[model samples]
Target: MTSNVNIDAHQHYWDPARGDYGWLTPDMPPLYRAFGPGDLAPLRTAAGVQRTVVVQAAPTVEETRYLLDLARGDDSIAGVVGWVPLDSLDAASILDELAREPKFKAVRPMLQDLPDDTWIAHAPREDAIERLIDLDLAFDALIFARHVPSLIEFVERYPNLRVVVDHGAKPPIRDGIDAGWQPWADGIAQLAKLPQKLHCKLSGLATEARKNWTEETLKPYVAHLLEHFGAARLMWGSDWPVLNMNGDYAAWHGAARNLTSHLENAEQDAIFGANARAFYRL
Candidate 1:
């Protein structure tokens, strides 16, 4: 019973009939299956999540349009961080088209597989990120710890872009070791100096820890980012369907509450929803 109105900032919805999630396969049940707003509503209600910011799961503009259409019809979905080909010659035009839709709040490029140091250095993609900045679209940085230095460079290069570090830069929780993250954490600390930066979806720590993670187990990672970014620079995100890979929505929320139990009510409120509302203009 936290009284703060919760906003699940990092959930996703997809339809197999609309497009194929090549990422989904027979090995991954539950998540490998289709999920739409309807599947999410009950979970959110039960977890006391009043609003949500739907994020892109697929790498297609059609997926963005589909999520935007869902957000249009669903008040509970407060905003959407959709996808577009950032390298496309008409990237600005595509972003302009998405901007016309009220719920289209941000965009993300799936950069997890790219090499840590040189991925963003790729000319066309760098230009694309620059375009997003010009358009006032927030970029959700989705990379592993190895990419931290490069991400730091990207942030410095685009000071105007509102960058959200997804999953606390997705620390290595599975191995129960964070020493690998010290350099990454230091890099984030440097990036935090930027006025517009923030972090998201405190939900993945369990998977990263890949142990029987309790609040104590997640404290080092959560507390590290919370300290660096402070409440104003932090936001809550369910990372929903992916969170399903670790546990259900309620379970993730419980873990988050436990980890932040020491914070004052207002601070908790900021991480839970208020920051997301203001960040996305939801």
Candidate 2:
């Protein structure tokens, strides 16, 4: 992976008017409206971000197509992590069609939203998964701590499928470390030990923590990831707009930088950008 190629590995663009974003309702003010490349361009410029990977906000194929269309006209967009109908018999064909687009770098099922925690583990989508491997696309596991064990099993089932744990499995830091750290920590530690194409994003920690969260508050969790996955397998992401719920893009980016200050410059660079570029093939 190349160094200093700064990228925001995870973020999203959604227009609530599309009516496809079920979770993004009017109650979530400040973020209930549309967010697009125009809104993010200044943030990226201020942070010196050369490019970004736009992950899907809605679970619909139409939303995925919407993101791909957004990427096509936006130079700062490095690639996209879109959704797939994993249960469909035409899953392979769908992936094949999406892969034909240059910026379609990965697929992410909203695993956390699904009722079954072990869906990925036992899902009858081997053909689609195998096709993903053949196409060199990655998997973005949007999960929580409860979903980690199942994710581990899924990764074990297909050791070669590139997988990244978005938001460090979303540890319950808002409840404080002592309250729920052990379960998330233990599960994540096990995930890191897997001998496969696995990685984790150092993003969304702020939103998961108390609204008044600081760098010190996030240190232990970030340290655990760095200790286990190392800089090479961990990537930085803004998790923007949703980040507006607790903090802004600059604030999150600054906190991540400070949290990783102890690392060597090169290692920091890898966590900040190169690892993401390599993982997403951006």
Top of the candidates by TM-score = 2
- Residues 1-282 of candidate 1: C-alpha lDDT, one tens digit per residue: 223668887888876666546677769776777788888888889878899988888888888998888888888888899888876787778888999998888998777854435565453466667767776678787877677667767667777878787888777766665455666677667766765554555655665666456666677888888888888778878887877777677877887887888899899899898888777777
True lDDT of residue 202, candidate 2: 93
Please list the C-alpha lDDT of all candidates, in the order they appear.
0.76, 0.91
Best by the lDDT measure: 2
| Worst lDDT 10-window in candidate 1 | 115-124
Q: Cα lDDT of model 2 overall?
A: 0.91
Q: Itemize residue pairs with steric clashes in candidate 1.
A: 173-208, 173-209, 174-208
Model 1 lDDT at residue 127: 62
Candidate 2: deviation at residue 107, Å?
0.4
